[model samples]
Target: MPQVQRVPMRAVKNVVLIAHDSRKQDLLDWVKYNRPVLREHRLFATGTTGALVQAQTDLPVTRFKSGPLGGDQQVGAKIAEGELDVLVFFWDPLEPQPHDPDVKALLRIAVLYNIPTACNRATADFLVASSLFHGEYERIVEDHAAKRQAWLAGQGRR
Candidate 1:
């Protein structure tokens, strides 16, 4: 079994919000409804979405480039660097995006880093309602480098 490490998370989480063009309104609604809970955390979003979120909810959000212009990659990099704590991406599954690959990579990195991610309103609501969201918590993640090294050593013996 791979070894695991526990990463401590502070009560004030760094959360990134994302939404496709078709789903921006839905995400806005969710954000507005949860403004109070979100006010306790740092918020981030892509260009248009961030503008809309800020304008609508009056919440301060750090804005990145538009997703097609590399915003998703920026978010993915942050996740890999352990800077982001949560992800709320309300993407339109039925629509095709020019930056689909970037979106996939973003989701992949989120899973790799073991961040709490929500793809829809229901999941977002559940995440916010969870007891862990309001307090300090430890995230357990496998030590991938060690596992790779072990596998490489075993290969040399074969």
Candidate 2:
């Protein structure tokens, strides 16, 4: 079992936003509606979504490569690096993605890192409206280093 560590969150959050091609509009609508709350935080997004969000909301958005071209991996790396505070992904459940494995890996990394994530609009609303949104919050981080080392020792690789 992994151990838990309490970590403090900053008042201003670093948020990652992503969406499938078909769900981009939905994300846009949601963001626009939540702009008052979202605008206060640092925003990151995959290519076209970033551009559209910036254009429509007039809010600054940091852009990564398109998801199919490794944007998901970029976000995952940031999560591993402990740079992101939240993930708002509006993925299309009905549509198949060419980089499905990457998407799964991204979600897994988020879970492993104990980042706050919202998969749909309702959850997104809750995240944004929570008192922790504008104040300091503590998160329980799952520490898996000892588990990995143990497994490696059992495999005769440590």
Candidate 3:
């Protein structure tokens, strides 16, 4: 039997922020209101949103390139590397994104890594208010395994 290596994701929290051009103002407002909670951990963002947040909040943010210009992929890579924990992306449903696949993959990686994510204000409230910043993020490796097993079982049933 081959040995399986488990890479422990660090306890550090990394929150990602993204919003469409239409939702930029909304994102800024959310950041302003939640600056105290948000400052407890590291922050990552794509270009314009990062610029906006940094200018207003004085929050130290690490910025990737523009999302359409491969920033989403960069964040996904960090997730894959077990470097990121939480994602607070405010995506606009009304707009069609040219980088939809990249965005979708980033979301999928978050799920795969058991990273917490919030796409809207309601979920964002739950995430930012939770004790995840002060302690460890709840990661369910068994959930991933169970879901895969269930999928295989259902396939056989079909």
Q: Name the top TM-score candidate.
A: 1
**Please, what is the whole-model Cα lDDT of each candidate in the order they appear?**
0.94, 0.92, 0.81
- Model 1 deviation from native, Cα RMSD in Å: 1.5
Tens digits of per-residue lDDT, candidate 3, 4-92, equal 33544445677788887888888899999998888877988999889999999999999988899999999899877767777888998
State the displacement of the C-alpha of residue 141, model 2, in Å, after optimal TM-score superposition: 1.4
Model 2 clash pairs? none
Pairs clashing within candidate 1: none
lDDT of 1 by residue, 51-155 (tens): 999999999999999999999999999988888899999998999899999999999999988999999999999999999999999998889888888988989
Candidate 2 runs further than 4 Å off: 154-157
Measured against the true structure, the TM-scores of the candidates, in listed sequence, are: 0.96, 0.93, 0.81
Comparing candidate 1 with candidate 3, which one achieves the higher TM-score?
Answer: 1
**Model 1: which ten-residue window has the lowest total lDDT?**
149-158
Give the runs in model 3 whose Cα sits over 4 Å from its true position.
1-12, 142-158
Clashes of each: 0, 0, 0
lDDT over C-alpha atoms for residue 84 of model 1: 88
